[model samples]
Target: MFSRFVAWAKRNLPTRESMEANRWLRPVAHRVLEPSLWRFTRRSVPRGVALGMVTGILCPVAQVPLSAIFALPVRANIPVAALTTFITNPFTTPPLWVAAYWIGSRILHFGEGMGVEADAARGWMEWLFSEAGPSLVVGLTLITLVFAVVGYGASALGWRWWIVRKWRARAEARAA
Candidate 1:
């Protein structure tokens, strides 16, 4: 199942072909698309997911570019890293921010008034800047870190489980 999903994802996702067309990157296109970097191997994909999650939350606006920056150095699956950033898109951001604020308030013990008051008197930006800013930053940072670690671990475990399942199936076939 995991193999199929990875295979499907690879097919659907864009390759470095478009990026390779860039004059600057064209010079290093081959290095950029090194097979190991794109392959759905246990190591590459997990690290790619971790890289993606970290960038997705931390650099919401430039998540893909940030993921690529990390992916190139580590040779993780570039497309997966880029794709995973979608986890924090427009619909999700508000809830995520809210959760982060709540978590930050608990962990850091920011006083009772973390809530945005019914301030028709002040704008949302003013509210965010004055009340929510620091806690949001700390909370988002912590959430991003936790997600990165968890994503990496889940991928690694999935890979192991897939390998074990394949081995069992092969052994059964041999016995038959």
Candidate 2:
């Protein structure tokens, strides 16, 4: 199942050549097409995962391009970074934001005066202008940082484990 999904992604996702030809990226096509950034090394893959998580969680718009650009500086795997941005799509965003708000409320001790329910009753503009605004911003920032750190650590550990497993499997096959 995972192999099929990977194959599908490879076939459907834009290629390096296609990206190079992109009108918007034409100015920096040379840098964007650098070979090192596209390689799937252990270091690059983990960096890409972290970068993707940060960009994906922090912003709802242009995450793929954002990750791709950031990946260049970090020498992260471009495709991995780009694909990871799907962590926050239309279907998952609402719930994620709600969770962020909940977390923010807890951390910031919101609703002490009139209560959270009363705050929710206010108009959208008023709510946004109130404590909810700072809470949401702080929550999103904290969530983004946490996700990036966790993503990086998990990917690094998973990559190391995969390599070790492959080595062991190869040794067993040779012995057989």
Candidate 3:
């Protein structure tokens, strides 16, 4: 039943060329990312996921750059690093940002009166820009750093366990 669904999904999916450049870009991505993935995979899935997630969140622009790091050991690294998307994907991004803001506010006492809303942070920032420029910058910087560290550490631990367990299973299968 699942196989039939998979086959149907594959058949209905758009052609490779019809997809966006990023879709078919994995080959190049693999070339660049394999090394990093390989090195990180040596640690474990949780570690790799943590590294990837932190990298992705801290500097979204660096996703490709970080992926290149993982691409080195294509087999182990890709899967582990790809797990980073658990934290970095589109759906989770906004929530993460909000959380970062809340954390920042708690630590800095800047947003106490503002309450938490999707746009509230932005409004707070805008107000800060006009009213407290240095404080805003400092707050944002601190928030970004905190989230990055937390994301990396948590993901790494979780991914490490996952990767190790998976590898062990594979090893047992091969031995069998």
Candidate 4:
């Protein structure tokens, strides 16, 4: 199921060859269109996910370009990195921000009552200024780091599992 999704996504993404034809991308084509950055190796995909998570969660607006920047240097799967930016869309950002503010307040000792007061306040900007602003920044940073780590670890584990599964299948076939 996931593999099918990945395949479809890969297909939908503009190929390196095509993207290079763009006047904007032409000058930097050598770096952006690096072959290793586009391949779907076990290592690249997870690193791409991590890079994407970092830029997507932290930058929000420039996630795609930021991911592309990081992916090029790290030789991560560029398409996967570009695609993973949607993790923080319009529907999901509000809740994540609220949760981050809450966690940040707790960590920074603004206390639960302050958090409640901030929440009940009229405007987000006002509530942010009262006490939660710094905490919110801290919380957002922490959350981005956590998500990036988790994404990278999960991909690594998945890659390892895939290798093991393939080995077992090959052994079974040979035995038969």
Writing each residue's lDDT as its tens digit, candidate 3 over 82-123 gives 445445678977776666666555666664565567345566
Candidate No. with top lDDT: 2
Candidate with maximal TM-score: 2
TM-score of 1: 0.81
Q: Estimate, for each residue in 1-176, the C-alpha lDDT of model 2 and write its tens digit.
A: 99998999989877898997889988998999988888889999999999999889896799998899898888999999989999998898888888888888778888767877786688988877776777888888889899999999999999999999999999999999
State the lDDT of candidate 4 residue by residue for 63-123, as single tens digits. 8988898888787899888888879999989999999898898888775554665566558
Please write out the lDDT profile of model 1 over residues 1-176, one tens digit for every residue. 99997898778766767676778777777777677887888889898999899889888687887788789888788877988887899999999999999888777776555445555567778867865787798899999999999999998999999999999999999999
lDDT of residue 130 for candidate 1: 68
Q: Which ten residues in a row have the lowest lDDT in candidate 1?
A: 111-120
Per-candidate TM equals 0.81, 0.90, 0.44, 0.86
Off by over 4 Å in 4: 1-4, 111-127
Model 1: CA > 4 A from native: 1-12, 113-127
* Candidates 1 and 4 compared by lDDT, better number: 4
